[model samples]
Target chain A: MNNDYYSKSYMPGIIKWGKITMLLGITLCFLPALVISFVYGYMPPAAAILTGLLSQVSVSGAFYIVEPISYFPILGIPGTYLTFLSGNTSNMRVPCSSVAQEAADVEFGTEQGSIISTIGIAVSVMVGLVILTVGAVGGNAIVGMMPAGMKEALNYLLPALFGAVFGQFAISRPKLAAVAAVIAIGMTWLLRNGFLDFMPGKNPPSYLVILIAVFGSIFAGRLIYKKELQVPEEEKTEAK
Target chain B: METGKKYLEMANSPLMWIAAGIAVFVVLMQSVIFFRKSLKAAPEVGLTKKQVKMAIQSSAISSIGPSIVILVTMISLLVTMGAPVSWMRLSFIGSVNYEAMAAGFGAQAMGTDLQHLTPIAFSCGLWTMILGSLGWLIFTLLFADKMNKVNHLLSKGNERMVPIISAGAMLGAFANLAAGNFFTETNSLTIGSAPSLACVFGCGIMMVLTKVAKTKNIQWLKEWSFAIAMFSGMFVGYLAR
Candidate 1:
């Protein structure tokens, strides 16, 4: 019933289970590749494998570290485990969790928020798996039947989804929202025009843009809301 | 083309399917376990049964649009990676874009491409896909539990600022992502640009839905608002295009 119970009791159990599942996930992820390579005697030359790994790593290595750290504040501990294991962090997990907290009227980053987000993300994983399984079984036929217009519309879904998510959060804090929008638009413009082409891949690294937008907004929030944020916790709640 | 057929035979083999099944099974098992644990702990965290139920319901509804998008995308992948690998990879630890790009790089490394895959090139793709994403698992395993310190440091020991910080991060991340879509190399806020239209329409619909749901005391509207906003946005974008 108390905060101590959640912090001390509930959290440790989650951490224990999270670690175990993550370990299992890691092992299982390699199973298909291993089976294909060794059991079937289809292993590529070691040199070729190394080249492939290096090429993919050269492009994506930064994301592995940057994404997890940047998303931690929103995803929380249990969410980090579920999200990283289940993937689709931006497109699915984050929106599902954020909407869950909003619909439940729970504050983010609290114990309640963590529990609610875990439920949301777990539900998403189950739902996603069921849909994907169906797709795998007969998706090609169904997709073939789809009209070209309908198929093309799906291309716009990610942008729409992102816009909806931003709206949900921004409505509550317009000033900070403006700050984020300005930085994001400006950075995107710079990236598009070769302003950041000096970076790796002859373009601005996405992770760097993300880092700047996130921290820049946070810095703005801290500066803009300093007085409200500095009030003692009990007094703030009492005033509300 | 002959090598492509041989590669498909191996890729779609029963053994490969079984391996993919095992991988998907692990993901399912983890979700179930975490779901049960969280449900058990809900009351302790002061989440009423109704709140928990709504959370699940809303989240499930929200996932439908994106999941369908993923399914359609998977159809393209199925042609190249076979049903099992496409299913398993998309279900766990990688997005459609990441998997396709990684697999392409893998094949390119072996002097082949997705269209003309040899068995060895296919294997190379699988290896690259697995290895490239390994860092996310390794990093999270090492630091997820310890990341509370990140929040602690950001909040400067002021618990109240945690929510603000989180909100700021959400706004920033989503804004950046949405902006990326709205602005392309060849276009900037051009009329009838599908991505720009989608972003603008999505945001507008959401704001209206939120206002109406709150003013009208329509709980169902609140629950389905996200899906409605998304579909409406996409439909408008389609028409504009």
Candidate 2:
């Protein structure tokens, strides 16, 4: 079944389409900048542009590599393409994908899982764009009318989201979840105490905590569940 | 040239809207194409039509709360960056935190802030925001297809290990994100803080929802669990504060 799925040309075709869309996305990324700078004749000084670029890069340069790699296992190929292009990976895309897979009863990291995640991510991108468009048109008035308490609650959205997603996944693997949480919280404590100040900037780069936690849990999972993780050849064939 | 108000006028000009519209159009087109392709291919992967419908419905419903959060951020971005650029950036490869910081850096590089803006400084801010996000696109373009090899190597030729690896990564990533919220610059141990309490509440609610949904075979409850958990947590946090 695995061979049949890959050899059927669906995977390769999606990859090709993904690359094309991403290239188009890259070119489109420059449209607003190009139009404003050239057509409007408000070009910035070269030095200022360089200074601005460098400062932004200093903060986000590491994330460029770290985020895509870290997210690929969960997102798969087409979902990865849709996600990086659409933005809001962790907050929007990943959660959508996870929920879709669960709803469909698909196993993560499988071909079916990837297809379901792709559908989920695509739906999110469309829904998000529509909401953003509406918000752009009349958001100021809506925001002004919102109650103060609700506005304050919005501040906790990210934490609540992360916690809920963690809980969703943790129900299946309590041991691995506990181990991962300990490592992550410990890293956060170290970051807060200035122990990681030796790295760069006033604080260490935040991705370090993510890197340690992800790989650390993977290593721990392997050691703790080596036997269970191994698939018998007969069962594999039977599954097919 | 006049500076303060005129800069915003230019930022919100018709030409700026056209340019921003092009970017947003590209994003929409990509999503539509990918969605169609995946839905077509679903049956070959052994997914039922009913399952596909459920996936789409659940994901769309799941997106509402987060999209509202993004909408609030969009309002703030519109105030600082003007409607055109704010709409384009938020629709494309930009996040709420990154867009604000990049725009600030660009303005600062020109020796002015976002508030006291000049045309040139505005252009610089635009340039900075554009350039800051290019790295992710470029890196993904070069490496996304090749990542399959990395996955294979990680699994050491055991296909079954892939699911385990994926789960571990998800757990690890969420753990980092949730834990990060518990510590702020001003407060070290903020366990009882609104955001931290929200996290606790969200987790607790989800655990109960999932257990009930699974044991009782409540299909609709399973689908709506995330939104219910998230909003309940937010409400509890609001009341606590």
Candidate 3:
């Protein structure tokens, strides 16, 4: 029942299992590649594989670092493991986890919030799996039946989802929300305008822009929380 | 050409499906295990059964729209990559664009395109796809357990600051995402000028829904607010276009 018991006992087990499952998942991801190479009697030249990796990894490799770190504060322990493996971190997992935390009335970054987020993420993964499986099984017939306008509408739903998510949180902390929005939009503008493309040869990746916004807003929030409210030490220690 | 057709056949063969099935099964197990563990831990963490169930229900509902997008992407990939590979990669780390690009790069490495994927090109593409995700998997496996340090470092041992930092981070990340969609290069700004319209509609709808839920104490409205906002935003976006 101690405060750190979950962190001490529960987390290690989760991490251990997380490593195993993730490693297995990664290996399984390679199974198709291995099977194809073997069946076709044609091992792709190492140079070709390297060339492909060079093209793709140079772009996305940074996100492996930026996304996990940027998303860590909200995702917490178990949510991180499951969300990473199940994919859809930004579009699906982040929003789903945050909504679950909000609906449960749990403060984010606490034990309760983490549990609720895990539950939310797990459910999302299951539901996503079901939806994808149905799509795969039905193939083109299902999507083929939909009207063009509806499909186009579906394409635009993500921005709406993002807005909904931002609004849901912003309602609670308007000032910090405004700061975050402004910083995000401003930074994006800079990115679009080539203001932040200072790298010698490479354009600034979008993930780095996201990372900057995440940390920038966090710094701003800390300042506002500390300066705007000059309360007693005990009052500021409201953990629950 | 026979080799190419045979590769596609093998890619969709029972073995490949079985492999993809096992991989998906492993991911599903991770979710189940985590869900069960969280349920067992909920009471200790001051969460009620009702709260957890509601969280699950809301998340499941929230997933419907986005999962439809994923499904659409999968159908597109399936035509080219075959069912087994398409199912595995999409259910893995990358998005539709990422997977498509990785596969395309893989093809291009062999001086070809994804249109008529030769066996060698397909193999190279498959390798590229696998390698593309390794960075995330490796980083997470190595660093996820240690990420708690981030909270501790950010909060400086103050519990009150924890939630604030988390909220700030969440706001920052989502704000960046939403801002990109909301703001684009447009000659003129109007109610329906750009994709920003969706952001406006989504946020506006959410704000209204939150107000009504609070004033009326209609709990279900609060739960469904996100879905409503998203759909309405999409509708507004459609009309604008």
Candidate 4:
């Protein structure tokens, strides 16, 4: 049942076509501005444009580097393209991919795992699109109809969601969970106090905190795994 | 050239719709193509039809709550930007908050506000939105296939190390995100514990559900564990407020 062909044959084409479609898609996204500016002859001044980009990118530019790398292990390849294209990685795509892998009883990083994860992400994206489309078409009437209390409660949903995800992982692996919590909390505390402000830009250095926590936690997991589960070299050689 | 209200008309014009529609169509095509490929490859991967169906249902149902929040954001964006740009941006790489912020910046750059955007303001706003998100897409496009090398290098070609590293990455990323919510600025001015309480409630409910599922073997309980935890946490958080 192992279809190595997916990796051998299918994945390269998927990547190739994915890049083409994505490039076209990205280009189309910018088309509106180009067309509008040309038609109206109202192109924004270069300084103003640079100012806007500088402000936006200064805030989010680090994320562009960190997020894709941080999320790579979770989303894998096909899921990577789809998740970035669709956005909402942490809240939707990652969870969906995890659920699919769990339901399919496949290990992550495996071919089967990748397939199931891809399907899960696609379904999530399609559903999200449908819901958004409906909301857009229906306008605010639908949102206005929601109870005031429920709308207020929506603020807490993401925290709850993040907590639930963390809990799931924690329940499965308490030791690693402990390691992550310690690093996250300690680093967050330090960053909040401006302990790392001297490093570079900004007061908090939030991206650095996340990166440290991620890599630190990974190191901890590897340390624990090697001490705990690694087979003896002689036994491994014999088995091979 | 169209100016004033006439300029605004272009925001939702047929030309804009057609262009935005093409972008959305490309996204849709990718999703459909990937979905079909996965389904075709499912049997080879040991996925039963039932498992795939359950996965689909679980993910679809799970997404509704989050999607509702996004839809609400879209509604707000649509007021200023019109349907076509709002729909396309939100459907593409744009998240709710980021899109609004980008639009706002775009408007500001044009020396206007989002509410009273001229055609030029709207156009630049669109540009900012497009450029703001290109980093993620560009990174993915250039490096997605190459990232396999990262996995390999990290694992040093050890298959077992792969999952450990993945788990570490997942846990660390989620922890940092949750930590921000749980541990907000706590000083003399104000306290923001609602998010933290919601998070604790979510974790608590999940732990309890895991216990119950293990003890009772309630299949549905396991399936709905995360959703239940999340909603319950939200309710508690609301009450706490």
- Give the winner by TM-score: 1
Rank the candidate models, highest lDDT first. 1, 2, 3, 4
Could you give candidate 2's per-residue lDDT for residues B104-196 as a string of tens digits? 999999998888878888889999999889899898888888888888887898777786788788889899989977876663767887888
Candidate 4 lDDT, B69-147, residue by residue in tens: 7787788888888888888888788787788888888889889888788877887788888888899889888998899
Better of 2 and 3 by lDDT: 2
Candidate 4: clashing pairs of residues = none
Off by over 4 Å in 3: A1-5, A200-204, A228-230, A233-240, B1-6, B183-191, B211-217
Best by DockQ: 1
Question: Which scores greater on DockQ, model 1 or model 3?
Answer: 1
Best candidate according to lDDT: 1
Q: In candidate 1, which residue pairs get closer than 3 Å at backbone N, Cα or C atoms, i.e. clash?
A: none
Ranked by lDDT, the better of candidates 3 and 4 is 3
The true-versus-predicted C-alpha distance at residue A223 of model 2, in Å, is: 1.9
lDDT of 3 by residue, B54-152 (tens): 798789888898898888888888877888788877776767778888999999999998887987888888899889888888888888988988778
- lDDT scores in order: 0.85, 0.84, 0.81, 0.79
Q: Report lDDT (Cα) of residue B90, candidate 1.
A: 95
Candidate 3's TM-score? 0.93
Fnat per predicted structure, each in turn: 0.76, 0.76, 0.75, 0.67
lDDT of 3 by residue, A17-131 (tens): 8989998887877777777777656689999999999888878877888788878877887888888898888889988998787666677777888889999999999998888
Against the true structure, what is model 2's DockQ? 0.69
| TM-score for predicted model 1 compared with the true structure | 0.95
**DockQ for every prediction shown:** 0.75, 0.69, 0.67, 0.59
TM-score between candidate 4 chain A and the true chain A: 0.90
